[model samples]
Target: MTQYIGRFAPSPSGPLHFGSLMAALGSYFQAKSQQGQWLVRVEDLDPPREQLGAADSILRTLENYQLHWDGNVVYQSHRHDLYQTQIEQWLSSGEAYYCQCTRKQIKAMGGFYNGHCKPLNHQDPAGCAVRLHIDQPVTEFTDLKHGQITLPQALAEEDFIIKRRDGLYAYNLAVVLDDIDQGVTEVVRGADLIEPTGRQMSLYHQLKQPTVSYLHLPLALDENGNKLSKQNHAPAIDELDTQATLLRAMDCLGFAIEPSLKDGTIEEIIQWGVQHWSISQLPESTEITPRFSNGSV
Candidate 1:
């Protein structure tokens, strides 16, 4: 049997908030439960949006919470050559083409790219983004947690961009490539990314690689009902009280920590979690506002 491999990829846009921690811990527990390898990757692909020192801070925070990974952390910024190589191959094989269309033009065309540049065959790489030509788009995929999910026809059929006009590799491109390179067997993250699963699966098909399994946890919402995210100014996890924070995250994942282990150490809590983790116990909803003991998330 092949060893199960999972990862927790975090972007260096800000510190890990409660929602982010839920993803990290969920991935960690899932991996450890199966006695598999759990890896860490810093998705610092977009340097302009990345906060300085945020990557290191994320690693340190993981350590504080005792979420040790199996190998050295992989940074997306260091793997530009790998992405460029794939793009070059796609271009040469006519699987991808350069698009000169701007965001305004795409918006005018029903907000979804209509594959206008494929026939144009724009050669100049200057001021042009590269888009993969989707011959057979994946409209639906079975999520480990959510079951069969069908995507909108336009979204599933759109010739999505692999490289941006600003010379940055798109998230869908980098994430799929990185997951393949790392030999990741499963992707355990938040449901906020559930929409991109089909696109990523399409990339896997394009690359002729088997797609990994996906387990998307429920999205943690804030007081105002928005996702608890850095973009929303969500507060960072309180490192001073790692025990309480870990328990809260576990609760969000549907783990009812036994009273015998409620006051356990961080390592003890993680061990108990791994031994008792069950995907079926997870809440069925995609978005949920977590409830805690003290009326605080």
Candidate 2:
């Protein structure tokens, strides 16, 4: 049997919150349950949004919770050359083209790119963003938790940007390339990214790379049904109370913890969690209210 490999890639825009913990614990438990390798990748692609010390703080938070990874953490910022190499290959092969359309122009065209720049054959790649001319559309993929997911045909056919005009690699391009390069067999992340699955799968086909399995866990939402994220000002997890935080995160994942394990160490809790981890047992809803200690709910 082929060994399983999973990863948890998080942006270092802010400190780790309950939602982030849920994704970390979910991916960690899923990988460890199968005795597979679990790796962490710091997705610091967009430097403008990254906090001063959020990357180090996130690593420290993971360590405090005993969610140790299998290898040294991978950072996307140091991988511009790798991404650029693939971009150049696609451009040379006519698989991708340069785009000069601004966001405001696309919004004016009913919020979807109309492939305005595909016919231009723009040669100046310095200021223009690169877009993949998607000939084959990825309509559907079976998610482990959500089963068959069919994306809108228009969305599947739209030419998406691979590199931004700001000279930064787009998330879709970088993530797909990284996953392929890292040999990741399975991707376990939050359901908020479900919409991007089809695009990434399409990229896999375009690059002639095998698509990885996907299992998007339910998102942690606040009282107003907003996702718990740095943009929403979600409080960071308290490392000092790792035990409680872990238990709460497990509970959010629909794991029924025994009262006896209330006082267990992080290791003990993780061992128990791996033993009982079940993707099929996860909540069916995509959004779930996370129970926090500060009575924020």
What residue runs in model 1 are displaced by over 4 Å at the alpha carbon?
293-297
- What is the number of backbone collisions in each predicted candidate, taken in the order shown? 0, 0
State each model's CA lDDT, in order.
0.92, 0.91
**Tens digit of per-residue lDDT, candidate 1, span 80-121:** 999999999999999999999998999999999998999998
Error of 2 at 151 (Å): 1.2
lDDT of 2 by residue, 38-124 (tens): 999999999899999999999998888889999889999989999999999999999899999988999999989999999889999
Q: Which stretches of candidate 2 lie over 4 Å from their true place?
A: none
